[model samples]
Target: MHEAKSQNISILSYLANRFDTPVMAHIAFVGINKSFLGHYVGAHEVMHDVMTKLNGTRRLGLPSRMIDRLILVFTVSCCWLAAWLDINVLSIVESFAGPAGAIILLLLPMYAVRRVPALAPYRGRISNVFVTVIGIFTVSAIFYGLLG
Candidate 1:
């Protein structure tokens, strides 16, 4: 439980180490909601597609094919977000953490998900928490790589 919370704040603390509170907050917002990124000409439609695919995955209980889709999109999305933020945010994260961090961040969700003991029956709640953290770390890794 505690490690999860720590991971939750890890990005914030990491940002605090590098920037003032406001800019950190701005980056946090961008990394999370991603609506701000949608201000770009086509970002909105792309977001809709991602969201739809994600929702369907959840609704279908994350079949293997969907999981693969999620993994691929998650990786490519991290690269794209990292590249975009690098250009828009002065390249702080990219220079600081680079592709390695971005890739690790993108893989965090899979890490958390796979941590579950398969011998035991599935627990949706716990799985959700870990996966959520993974999502946060993955995108933060991108932004962090781009603007850290």
Candidate 2:
């Protein structure tokens, strides 16, 4: 919550500085409510997905409801600790965003197109090669920037 608020203010501050008008930033911030809600919804969905996958593994003897509660509590505690410790949010994002985005947005779609029967008809398109090349380049560039 604190991070989100600070991020919003920093964005608004950037807009104001860029435009040389606080009024414009305020106007833009009005439209930011949608983005703010989207972030929260995305986080919720990701957490739910994690819980679902962990429950499916059945490696733990715990009940599904108990596992979900435990995950929720753990997530909340981690968030609280990060906030209290003033961890650098951007560093955390930088560490995970590259690999996660590459896998989720790039690799998975390509895999589905190539291997899934329902998506088989879409395979062998020139766009697939183009997108794969672009995705690889983007991910490579991200890693290069992080490393160099």
Whole-model lDDT values for every prediction: 0.56, 0.74
Cα error, residue 92 of model 2, in Å, equals 3.3
Where model 2 places Cα greater than 4 Å from the true spot, the runs are 1-65, 94-106
Angstrom error at residue 103, model 2: 4.9
lDDT of 2 by residue, 35-123 (tens): 65677567767877777677678565566677567756876787789778888766667678887898689867988899899998999
| lDDT tens per residue, model 1, 1-148 | 3442444444654575456677777676667556334444265456556666776867855555655566568657875987665443323434555555644654554555557576234345566566667767766766665564
Q: What are the TM-scores, per candidate, against the unseen true structure?
A: 0.21, 0.52
Error of 2 at 98 (Å): 5.2
Clashing pairs in 1: 92-147, 92-148, 93-145, 93-146, 93-147, 93-148, 94-145, 94-146, 105-138, 109-134
User: What CA RMSD would candidate 2 show?
Assistant: 6.3
**Clash counts for the predictions, in order:** 10, 0
Which candidate has the top score in TM-score?
2
